[model samples]
Target: MLSICARHCVLWSIGRCANGCRTRTSHSSPRFPKSRSPTALPPMLKPSVRSAHSREYLGTWGISNGAQPGLFTGTCEGPRCDASGPEKGYTPHARVQQGFLRLLVRAQSALVQRSHHKRRNCAISGARFKRAREVVMASYIKRTIRLNPSQARTLSGFANRRGLSEYALLLKVIDAGFLALLHGTDRETDLAEMASVIGSISERLAERGTSREEASAAEKQIAALDTREAKSHADHKSLRADWRATAEAKGFGEAAQARAIAEAKERARAGELAASPEILAARAVAWAAAKLSERQAVFPASTLAREAGDYAFGRLSHNAISAAIAEAGERGALVPRAYLDRRGAESAGFTTPEAIATEQAMLRLEAAGRGVSVPLASSLAAARTVERAARQSARAGFAWTDDQKRATSALLTSRDRVAAVQGYAGTAKTTTVLATYAREAAKSGLTVTALAPTASAATVLGEALGLRGDTVARHLVSPEAKGLGKGAVWIVDEASMLSARDMAALMASADKAGARLVLVGDVRQLGSVGAGAAFAQLQQAGMATAKLANVVRQTNADTREAVMASIEGHAGKALAALERGGGDVIEGASRDARLATMAQRYVALSPTERVRTLVIEPSRDGRDTLTAMIRQQLVQRGELSSAAVRFEALEAKGLTRAETRQAASYAIGDVVRFARDYADKGVTRGSAYRVERIDPDKAAVALKAADGSSVDWRLRQWGAGKVEVFEC
Candidate 1:
């Protein structure tokens, strides 16, 4: 085989053989090993470059390094070599667009010649062959698109404006359109927002000069108000000082005198004295003034009206004041006017309008602890059926925690047909739902499905319930999904994350399917990414709800207590617990600096491929800053290459429509990470894949797996319609 193959390869080689025996060598060009025997040859394995994956495979065979296949010989020759083969079918100098095959042929011819004639008599390495071939026939497909008159005009205008060619302009337009579709934003809302922005800009321009003058006038008014306020406060202080002097002169400023007044109030309450306001005040004053002033400080009848205006605690009736003075004169306890003023201040603090309103609201919350119920249309008999199911769930053979059992019970026994089960983090809400699903499956063989506003959350729900999970949008669009038969039930997780619009759509779908829905989430966690709070509104509108309070996931009592406290809004407690656990709270001069510091700390952890840590950031800006810093650190550590430092410009949530359209779009060969898990397909969330092909017309995409295989991944799988592109 070696002899035959060597003869055949050598015959196919290019370059003239001085001996005219069909044997070839690179001796006419660079250095070539002298022929020991004209029977040695390179390996006959064919290189496959039909697809992107095939090119990668060829680069790794036999020769691990991606070197060209001229290693069998001591030299290599370019197309300029005096190499000749059977009739020279393809002239190496052809002006036609050279493709992979043309390049392959050129490389193979030179490699075969050197292999057959080389002194080593060794086979050519595959890695070297691929590189040599790439250097030869580098190819491209030239496609000419015919545009209509209007499109041509538009393209030319845009190109001229951008200082780019019409072709580049077209590419830009395509890229922008592709991103808009990938982001999945509401067109109407975007337009409305755009209009609002335009209006605001116009208004600001019109008001610029007027605003400066108005600001000046406002400053003058503020200064006047400050002056008046200062005078009024000084008068108040002087009045208080005078009242205190009178009280001290009468011995009423003593703590003992105040204590006596308190005792007298108690006695009056116990019926030891008259409980009338005048009598009570009189007794308090007389008891307080008794020691120093055998006579009480007196005000003239004519001056009483003027003096009463300075009285504290808003205004007191003249008759009441006169009666109090008379009693104080008789009791001989020096009651100071300053004491009355202090009492007024304390009363004002306690009975502010806002404080009273808050007290009323708290009362309402207490009353609504069991959750207000909406009347259901079901009859007693129908209700009893649900009640029985509820009982059975509690008795089911699932390993349910107390909280889980209660949560399931709440779902089954909700007074209103619509209800929510509010579970705190790590409270086994998912576990409870899965148990119910199993129970329903066993009794009536119902299709217990799970849906979420996001693909990732839905996937998690589906996994726990042993069913396929899908986004709520998918169920809403399919007519078949409407009115899930009576036996079917749908569980919606992360219910709090659904915007009002999404909630309405999901509800409409549920109504169509006639399937029962059980919403479960922790409201204290993140709300919807879009607009409006449907979950909170529903809870406020007297919707039936079961709030799961136990912190089931945290094993440490202190940590669990801290988590529960934080959820309940006890910031101090949460911080204390964290500090006890050796967690340090780092404060930076700015949020950006803090984020950078955090990135530095993460790098210091010395993470390996599988031992990575997660840095949870609350804001998008913080996340972006930390991400950039982390990328830079990785590059510095030699974990990433300079060429691989591509920023993943995605049209993710929280970006405006204009920004979304202007963001960078995905192209073939860009690496992406799956943001959601598709477990059945063995593609988990965070898994990496490369974009193989993109069809902007169809909004479709193809992905190449890590193992050099292709998967028909559609746009729907890309961040559940809002394609989350990332650099791996």
Candidate 2:
């Protein structure tokens, strides 16, 4: 039985087992066959027990490793050779079959282990694996959004026409959205509003020609929105207050109380403080604090109200003043109780001890040369020396009238470091006061530089003094100007027109050079154009000023009296004086009729007389109309060419089709006026240009200056709000 089993085992290993296996060569690997009809032997060859050789074959396959255990073994003599396992005795063939099944299980597990080891050894590192995962995720990261059907269709069409992909079009939209948000505004709403404004402006430009009306309308719209929103916020605050009162009545937290107070402040900011006594008082204190300064620090109730404007002053009743005083009295530092009286008048102003000390310290530093500025000098004796020198120079150089001598003597004898020659128009300030000062300073071995805020003023002064004068920005305050000697004198004309900051800078510059500054202007004409009312402030601060009430420029007595009355702010007297000068008020039924009559009168004059005549109008629009009429009349008289184009002033927003058309109409050899100064090119505000070339596509308008130099500028540039290019 063992011999037969061993042969059968050999046959099975080589794929030729007689039981059911098909035979193959020894060199060939063995495999179990599915069909056994052609290879199966009859049941006679089937062993019941005693298949020793098969057990040996099983051992070779590692089935013998479990022989000593309770597992299956290929021996019929063992009690474990039963069908259940080696626990019960089994047939030899059955035992061999169990060993073969175990061998197949072991082979499968080994194959799984080998494959797992290969996977572990060839696995990716953490970083490399993460990078690979990111690459895969990046391919799917793009978001897909649905657009409205019509919008999608239109966008697709536009993209196709522009040779751009749908994705590229989306990117373009995103870029525009980013720019709108860059200014820290609401992107969607702001962009939409701006687009609407632009569309309206463009349509208006196309239809009626460009004007400032559209820009004004846009500003009004924005203002209206702000007002509406403020009202809404105020309403919300009132509603919140009602809820907050109830919350506090119940046992609410500190946060709720804090929120209530914050909402109240917001309501005040929205101008909803009419019913709130606390907010009104707080507002008064804040307003007074802002207006307080060392120059004019005290505040009487009436004066404070006047500074607050007519609208606010009208709102301030006795009750309002009482409420403000009551609240301000609670805070001694900001609004001191000592400052407020029973009548609600604040004698001093809302200021702290620290602030007062700081101001005093600054004044001390200024006297010490650390913060020396434009005002009266620290030394009275030094100022007297400078004044004496000016007087001596004037006396030795030229003969003068009694009034001129008096004015010259007054300026020279002034004790204030910053002296003003307060003279009205036609007072011979340029010829008498300024000229004498310049000549006197020069004779005293002092460098006298005449300066004015504007080029025209400087030129007038320069021509009158026979010494070239420059704008204050160019000569005194300019960084490029050489340092002045100790005895240098700056004769500043039109000194009243300077803003506070410019005045301060001028003073600081003068102080640095240890120079004497003589400010010359008519204070009664107009105050500073910008801010702080420097001339007025200094005059009020007790600076020495020479008053020149006598008029010398106007030869006619009636004209002189009219000028004097106007300068003194006597309206009725000024009108009477004008009537005395044979100046009558003219009235016409319409502006057009008045313009027509004026044109006829101008045309009736001889060419020489007409050239000397000047027409002045109160309004810019009126001036433009009169200019057009005068130009048309000049053309009729052959004084001007018909080819001259009337270029309208550009509005603040942007250029319109009408302006572009006017600019493009200029041709070669046409002369045009530069409406603004281009200082870098030495072209003044009213410089003339002769057009040499024109390119409409590039918006280029090439011009040759009077000096024969040529430069090209864009038509749009020439039509900026600050500039206008009119055919000359």
Candidate 3:
């Protein structure tokens, strides 16, 4: 079978030799037919049968079988086949044929195995290549897009504005556009649904009529109800009073009559007889009138309204109070007036006729003092000479500017009994200008007396002017004021702090003594705490005023500019200047944190800088917080002593007169400062004493002085504005 198969293979090879040779045979194999050449061969045998060795073997078989030999001999010549064949003289035996057949079978089997391995390897390689291609494609895809000139310019402009490259900007635009596309459908759907809902709601509202008309009708109904309620409440009160009177007149016992009245009142309350707007308004008006009478001065309408609301247990509104006030004014029950408040803004309030009369008297006194003029002790020429001489003889290294010289000359030449010198802060008002004026006045043989609203201010003024100092309160009641006759110049520093009443008294005293009154201070620094802007008012009233305009204290130009701007009421500009000048503007996540940072920075400053620093806190609570924080920092840095002393100190309670009259308000260990002298009780004005004992039964309080002396003070004498109480 092997030989026959080999013979068939040889026959097939010989039939289709590359040399155009053929073999004829009567018998044919099924794979190679008798009348056709072997054009197609099996896949396994194609390589082996096409090789030179196979061709040589076939040639040997063909020759041995008496067929052509050269047909297969030179057929396998090319790069695809080795030219070498079986060695010369080699016999084509049966064993050799069998070995060649086995070799061919083994080669076919190996080829089959290699083909399978290649197919498997190709599948794996194709999968990996596909994955790598997918990743590369996903990472980035370069695409060419066509754009019009306008679109290109717009894109370039957008990229420039965004500080991005054109490529990057385009990518961002594509990403944003994709996101917008994804969300656009949802947004449109939402809008359509909203429109549908709105349409439905509009139809519903239309069916119910217009909303504005309904609201107006509801308001009218409410107003009518309020009016009816007020009338019902008044009628119920009258009916209850009439029933009580009838019951008492019908010989009912006291208890029975009281019970009847109580039951009637209860029934009225249980019904719709609640107090209405009119009643509340009337109560608010009455309360405000009482407050005006008690304070004996005009207070802010808004403040009074808030107080009235509290008094009425939140029954009164501000509008109700205002309306009541207007009605009372119309009926001559109250007087409505407007005055310039501390901030130089007009404020409206209700005042009593008596209070108005008092204010008129104060104005008249101011006018009278202005009318009285004081002749200078010397001629104008002599005063000018004296001023020039004083300026020339100023302390070493101290030179007066033109503004200071002018201010001094004005003060010296002024003949008005009440004169004013308006100077801003840091203008050397007291140290240079006023000092020069005082020296010139002294040289002119006029006695200059220094006075201020506060003792510390007076001390500063006296030290600057080289004279004795005294507080305005003390000076007013002292014998020195009585002797202030002609040739005396009374210099009042910090005169802006003087209330209208105090100014009137001081002017009257100066006028009567024929003394020239000099009012020196900055109106913008701090205004009068009591009732009036007398300093600014006097200037506005056409009184002779000498204004010191040049600021000399601040040497830094930026700081000076800021101060000038603030003085001129340019707060925003002043703040900007301060920032530009490197001012410490501490800011933090919270107010406490900012304050803590400020305290830390303050502690970091040198001792000299700390002494020069001025911290202005608008509220007492804030001031206390800042002070505590600063002290804590100082202690931590060993700049301040860690030890502390606790004692009773007077802090103004700012209570009302009625609140202060209750003896229960007086607590032991609390300190009180007398605003007026109580000589009989050994308590002097402006003196603070601790309350050693409080006796509510006797309506008296025993106060111990700082010197260990005790005095009994009547509780009634501790009214508001007379004595300030401080909790220990």
lDDT of 3: 0.58
- TM-score list, all predictions: 0.36, 0.40, 0.53
Which structure is stronger by TM-score: 1 or 3? 3
lDDT of 3 by residue, 312-387 (tens): 5566677877787777788877777674464779887767665555556656666666545644444666456546
Under the 3 Å rule for N, CA and C atoms, how many clashes does model 3 have? 0
**What is the C-alpha local distance difference test score of candidate 2?**
0.49
RMSD of 1: 41.2
Off by over 4 Å in 1: 1-401, 413-416, 590-593, 606-612, 634-647, 653-728
Candidate 1 colliding pairs, count:
29
Answer with 2 or 3, whichever has the higher TM-score. 3
Compose the digit string of candidate 2's lDDT tens values, residues 1-728.
Answer: 11112222232222212122222211111222222111111011111222344321122222222211112223233332234432112222322333333333333233333444444221111101112211211001112112211111111112342354332333233333322221122333422332243334334444544432333222322232332211111233334465345445554546766577657656744554354645554565454444442223233445444433322445566566555655554665343413544355556434444344443442332334422333222245334544554466568773344555566666655444456777777767777667756765676677877888889999888889887879987776465344764767788888888766567777767766777778888776665544345666566655667767677667788888887787766778988888888986566789988887777777888879977988777876787788789888888888788996556443232222333333445566666565678776556776667778887544567778888877666654443334444443
Q: Write one digit per residue (lDDT tens) for candidate 1, span 1-728.
A: 01113332221233322122222221111122344311222122122112222111111111112333321111113332233422221111111111222223333345545555443222322111111211211111112112211111111113333354322233334333322222222343533232232233224434544321222222222222232211111233334565456555555576757578657655644663335666555543332222111111222332332333232122346667666655443554322232112123321101122222333443343234343332222355334544554566557743446565555555554544355788888887776544563455435556777888899999998898877888888877765576455556677889988866567666656555555666788777887765445676667766667777776687787788789888887889988887787777788998878888988888778667327667889877678788889889988998878676455564333332221122124566666566577765556577667778876433356788788867655442234333355433
Clashing residue pairs, backbone N/CA/C < 3 A, model 2: 79-88, 79-89, 80-86, 80-87, 81-89, 81-90, 82-88, 82-89, 82-90, 374-507
